[model samples]
Target: MARVRWWGTGLVVLVLLILGLVLPLVDKALGSGGTALAAGTVIAVGTERAGARPVTFTVPAAGWALDEARSSLTSNAEVTRGEVRVDLNLVIPLGSLDNRRLWDGLGRIVAMGGGRLPGGPSAVTTRHGTAGLTGPLAGHGKIGSATVFTKSDLGATVTASGPPDAYGRLAGEVRAMVLSVEISP
Candidate 1:
């Protein structure tokens, strides 16, 4: 009985020593791998055709994952941290439309109807061209905003929403992403 007890204690001590040494190494490896995955890398969002300047933006790899259900009409991704969920989308105008008309029409589509948005429509400009921005619209169940811009024959829209305070915090990063968008001239 004494010998058996000694063997059991020795086994427990060996297991504890192995775990203590291995756990810190595992943690360190994961920490560095996360930074390496996100470092200076920007994902391209848009079609790759003969000549198209797709929007490119960098997102932290740890908290964000690219949603895979995108279709021709909507190219999008999502990021979540704590209580906030942000949906990033590049909305393509359906069918064929002239550049001038599309630019003009953005307000109508985003407005949805009069009295829907807090401040109605306002003129805005992006790296690509002049755009219409609207919302944090009323009755949307969440704080939200939309930006409409054009590139060559394509029109793009970005909509973002979350709890008002959290959404406000993300606004700068969102704008930076939008500004980084380069449309082929």
Candidate 2:
């Protein structure tokens, strides 16, 4: 019994030592990793074949910033470049977590990335006598049930708008890259 108790005490001490040394490093590693991931995703989107001139944007209402830009094609078909800015707000279920909360989920996810508006300078480009976009977008929403749904589910209306045919297709990729991204909280 004495020997067994000694062994147990030794195990506990070893566990504590390991935890004390590891937790802080783990937290820091996670934070840095999140930053790198976000950066890479943004850069990739900026470089896509959508058009040219990549720019980043910041929206105060959404509490986030994203990189964006514009592009073009061989054909005279023009584009506006990056033309939309989104600001996201997060909300939680006020009533219950059941059906009521499920319904509340809409307001939250809809508010995800805040709201969209006429994008500003960096992302906008003038070509073919029209304006279009090809860039990155960054913003934040809230956490809670609504957030959960946004991550797990995104709707069609969330799709982007741009030129047509090839240029439009490329712009769609940029939008996909933007939406797929989720900054660390």
Give one clash count per candidate, in the order shown: 0, 27
| Top-lDDT candidate index | 1
How would you encode candidate 1's per-residue C-alpha lDDT over 3-103 as one tens digit per residue?
Answer: 44588889999999879998888887654221222433455556765654355445533454344443232255554443344444554567764434553
Model 1 ranges off by over 4 Å: 1-40, 51-53, 58-63, 69-74, 79-115, 127-135
Name the regions of candidate 2 deviating beyond 4 angstroms: 1-4, 26-31, 35-123, 126-185
Q: Would you estimate the TM-scores of all the predictions?
A: 0.54, 0.22
Task: Point to the candidate with the largest TM-score.
Answer: 1
Candidate 1 collision pairs: none
Residue 80 miss distance in model 2 (angstroms): 25
| Model 2 worst lDDT window (10 residues) | 70-79
What's the distance in Å from true for residue 136, model 2? 15
Compared with the true structure, model 2 gives a TM-score of: 0.22
Compute the lDDT of residue 40 as modeled in candidate 2. 30
